[model samples]
Target: MARLPLTILGSVLFVAGCAGEEAPGPGGPGGPPPIVDANGVVPNYACPGSPGCEKAEGPLLVGVAARPITPVLETWDDLDGDGVRGDGEPFDDVNGNGEWDGVWLAGFAAGRAATEIHDDVWSRVLTFEQGDVSVAMVGLDLVGYFQQDVVKVRLEAAARGLDFDHVVVTSTHTHEGPDTMGMWGAEFGTTGYQEEYIQHIVTQTVDALAEAKASQKAARMKVARGEAPELVNDTRLPEVIDQSIHAAQFIDEAGAPFATLAVWGNHPEALGSDNTQLTSDYVHYLREGLEERYPGTTTVFLSGPLGGLMTTIRITGCPDAAGVETCPQGTFERAEYVGKGAADAAIAALEGSGATIEDSPSLAFRRRSFFIQPTNTGLALLVLTGVLHRDVYSRDKKLIPREQQALLSLTNVKEGDVLIGTELNGVHVGPLAIAMVPGEIYPELWMLKPDGSSYIERPEGGDFSDAMPETPIQAVLPAGVTPVIVNNANDALGYILPQTQFDDAPPYAYGEETEPQYGEENSVGYTMGPTLTKEFAAMYGR
Candidate 1:
C-alpha cells in the first residue's frame, strides 16, 4: 500500500518511501536520530531530534504587542460620477461637532455610516516560540478580512522582516469598526474599501506582529475554561451554543502575567445596526476589563465557533440600569456590562482552575488546504466583477475560472467542483489544542446537545434523526484534550453550517418568520457544512 503524501504548510511532509530502516539521516550518530539537518533544523515538529527538537521545550518564549487600526475617513469615491467629494457624499455629524465626520462603519448591512470614534480599535498580536520555530496569532478589531487581504498582510509581515512558520490572523468580528470585508460598504453591493484604510490595517498588523515577536521572553502557559453560558446565546438555534469562555494565560519566569489569550463564541455586535460610532463594541471592553483586572497583562480575544448565529441576546431591557426598558440601548454602557461580565468569567476560569502550566510543552502545528464550491450568487458576482478577489484554483492546482463573468458559480468552473483554497490549522501546546477554521462554524457540530445526542436538523441525503454518535472534534481528538475552536481564522468563507441546518434550498427562508436564521443566507454554499466536517475529521486522523 502506498501512503499518500501529506504536506503541512508545504514544509512538514510525510513521504511514502520504498522501505524503512536507513543508516540514520542527519543529527549525528546517536541511535535512531530524528529527522534533522547538520544545522539541526527539523522541518517537521513531530519528528525526533535534539534537546528542543520536535518538542516545545525550555524557555517557552511568548510575547504580546498591539497597535491601533481605527480608520479615518480620508477620502470617498466619486459616487455621482463627479470628480469632487463635496455634494451628496456619505457624511454624518456623529460627534455633534457641527461637521460631517466622513467616516463609515463596518459589519452591519443596514448602511448606517460612522460618525465618531467611541473607542479605539486595535490589532492585538501574540507570538509563541521555542528554539528556532515560531508561530503567531493576530486579532484585529474589525469585521473579517477576505483571504486576499490576509495574504497581503502576511506578505507585508514577511517583508518587514517578521519571519514566522505560520501567522494565523482573525478579525474580532466587531460591527463597529471599519469595513474590511466589503459586504457592509456604502450600499450593500457597492464597496467602501478605501485603499488607504486597507493599507493602514496591513501595515499596522504587520508592525504589531513584529513587535510581539521582538518582545518574546521566557514564559509558561496555563489553559482553562470557565462557565459563561449567560454571556453567549445563539439567535438562530438557541439550543446550540459553545458558552465556555476559554483562556490561555502566559506567565514569565518571574511569575508576572505576560499575555492572556481568551476565546468565546459570540458575535461582537453589542453595538447594533443603528450604531454610527466606530468601536470594537464588547470586544473593546473585554480587553480593557481583563487588562485592568490583571495589571500589565495584554489580552487578545479570538472568536470561537459562533456561526450557529451566536450573538448577544437582544437587549430588550437594560438589566443594569433600572427604570428603563432600553435605557442603555446599544450604547457603550451596555457594551461595558456585557464585556465586563465575559471578562469576569475568563478571570474566574484562570484563577479557579489549576492548569498544568508546562515549562516545556510539546508544540506542533499542521496546515492543509482544501476547496469548496461557492454557490452564493451575490458573492459569485462580487468575485467575477473583481469587487472581491481571492485566489480561486482548480482541483489540479491551476489558477482557473479564467472567464470571470462567464461562470456565475465558481463551484462549477471545471468539470469538477472549483477549488477555493481554504486552510485548516491545528496547533498543539502540550495538552491544549487549538483548531483554526477558515470560516464560521456552528458549535453544535463540534459539541453535542445537553441530552448527549448529536444536535442536528434538516438532513439532505442522510437523515440526521437517526444518530447516536460523538461530534467530529470529539471523535477525532484524544480523550481529555478539549480542542478550542477558533472560527473565521485564516479566511472568511462565510458560515460553515451543519448539514441538517443548511437551508439554502427553496422555501428559502432559514429560520421562522419571527426568528430569522440569517446565518444560512450568509453561508458560501450548502457544501460547506459537510465539506468542513469531513476535512477536519480527516485532517486530525479520525
Candidate 2:
C-alpha cells in the first residue's frame, strides 16, 4: 500500500461580482466559470444584522417544496447486445419480456434494470431567508448527484432569476433509485445514465427551489436529536454506527408546522439488491410516516455519516410486515419498518425531550471550493473511458481535454496529475450548526466522547496502524450548539474514511480473508479521508 504525494490546493472564497455576465455551463469551454467572479470565486452573503451588512432586521422565513423526479422507463430491448437502443433493435413484444429497460437501478450489481415502480422519488427543497441572505437546502431521492450536475442546477436557478446566497443539494444515497452517477450502468465500461432523465432532474430541482423561495413565510425553529441503534447496521469492522437522528422543525407564526428536517445515517437500501422496483427505499417510508404524524408539514430527509458501510443488509431481530420478529432482508417490509422506526424516534425526541425553540435566529454560512487528486485507478478508468462524465484538472488547475484524457493510460495518473474539484459548506442557523459533507463520511471521523477522544477503537493490522485520528467535527463547534452533519451533499466521491482503517492492501484491517474490507474498493482513494478532515477543520478555523 504505497501512498502518493499529497497536494493541497488552496480554497476559493465566494465573493460578490459584477452583474450581467453569462454564466458558463458545466465544465464549460475553458473550465467551469467562477460562481460569480471572473477568478471562479463564489459570492458570499452574510447575515444582514451581523458585521458589514446593510439591511433591516427581519424574522426567519422558511418554505418547503417537492418535485417528483421519477424516471419514465423507455421500452428498449437492446437486441444487439450494445447498450444503446439502435434503429434495428426492435422493442420486445412479449407480455413478460425480460429485456433490459432503459432504467438501470443504481446500487449493488450492474444490469439491475427497473421493471416497476414501487414508490415515486423526488427532489425536496427547504428554503430559508433572513433579511437579504437566503439559502436553499435540497434533498434528492437518488444514488448520488455529481458536482457537474450541481453546477448545472445553480446556473439554471440563476438563469431563472432566482437569487440565493447559497444552495446545498444532497442525496439520500438510495440504492434502489435510478442510476444518476453513471457508475452503476449496464456494463463495466458502458454508462447507464440517461442524459434526458438527468436534465429533467436538474430542471425539476431548480423549479422546486424557486417554488420554495416564492412560498416563504415567517417561522420559528426548534432542533432535537434521537437515537435508534436497532435501525442501523455497520458491516465493516470497528462497528461504529451513527444511530443519532437530528431533526429541525420550523413552525409558522400562526402555530402551524412549516417543515420538519430529519437527518439520519444508514444506507436506504433496506429492500436490497434482489428487488428490481424503483424506490427511494426506506426514505420514502420515513417521509411518509413523518408527514402522516405532522399533518400539513413536509418532511425533508438528508443522509448523515454513512461511510464505513452503514447499511440495512444483514440486520437481525426486527419485526417484519407479518409481525414476525426477524430481520426482513431484501423485502419491502423491512424498509417500511426501519423508515417508520426512524420517524418514531424523531417524533419522540422532539416532543418528549426538552428542546429550545429559537425566534429571529441569524443565519451565517461559508462555502469554499477544494480539489482532490483521485487515486482510485478504477475510478480513473471510468472517467477516462467516458463512463463517468466529469472534468479532470491538472496540477496547475487546467482542464485535461477529453481527447487527451482518452489517450492517457492508468499509469499516466500520477500524484497531482488528475484532480476533481468539490466543495465544503458550513452554516449556522441559530444553535444548529450544519456541516455539508460531499460523500459517505465514516462515523469515526465525527464521533467523539466528552474528552474529545475517538469512540472507535483501531484494530490491529490496519493499513495505517499508527496514523493519528483526524479532528472530530464536534470538537471544533462553538459551545451550546447542536451539530447536524449531512453527507452525500453537493457531490458523492464515495467513502470518506479514517486513514488508520483504510484496508486496501494485504493483511486487511479486520482480518478478512481473500479480500479487503468493503469500503476501499468504492472509495476515491486513501488520501480522501485525511484531506476532507483537514479541510473541514480549516473551514471552521480549528
- lDDT per residue for candidate 2 within 1-542, as digits (tens), equals 00111221110101111112234422333332345444332433334443333343588888899999998765666677655566656664434555535688887766677766889999999988877677789999988887667767788887888877668889999988988866667754567777778889989999999999999999888888898788888887888877889888999988778699999998998887778889999899899988999999999999998887788766663766875666577888789888988999998888875666887776777676677777777667777676766556556655555567678667766655766667788878878888888888888887787676886556676778788867777777677778878988888777877888887777765668666777776777778778887887777778
TM-score for each candidate, following the candidate numbering:
0.80, 0.87
lDDT of 1 at 388: 48
Best-performing candidate as measured by lDDT: 2
Candidate 1: list runs displaced more than 4 Å. 1-55, 74-103, 315-329, 353-356, 400-417, 449-453, 458-471, 506-516
TM-score between model 2 and native: 0.87
Per-residue lDDT of model 1, residues 141-232, tens digit only: 87776654665665566567776656778877777887665555555456555666778888998888888988998877887788666556
- The parts of candidate 2 lying over 4 Å away from their true place are 1-56, 75-101, 320-327, 401-403, 456-458
Model 1 residue 444 lDDT score: 68
* Candidate 2 backbone collisions, by pair: 14-42, 15-42, 15-43, 34-40
Largest TM-score belongs to which candidate?
2
Residue pairs clashing, model 1:
457-500
Error of 1 at 156 (Å): 2.6
**Residue 294 miss distance in model 2 (angstroms):** 1.1
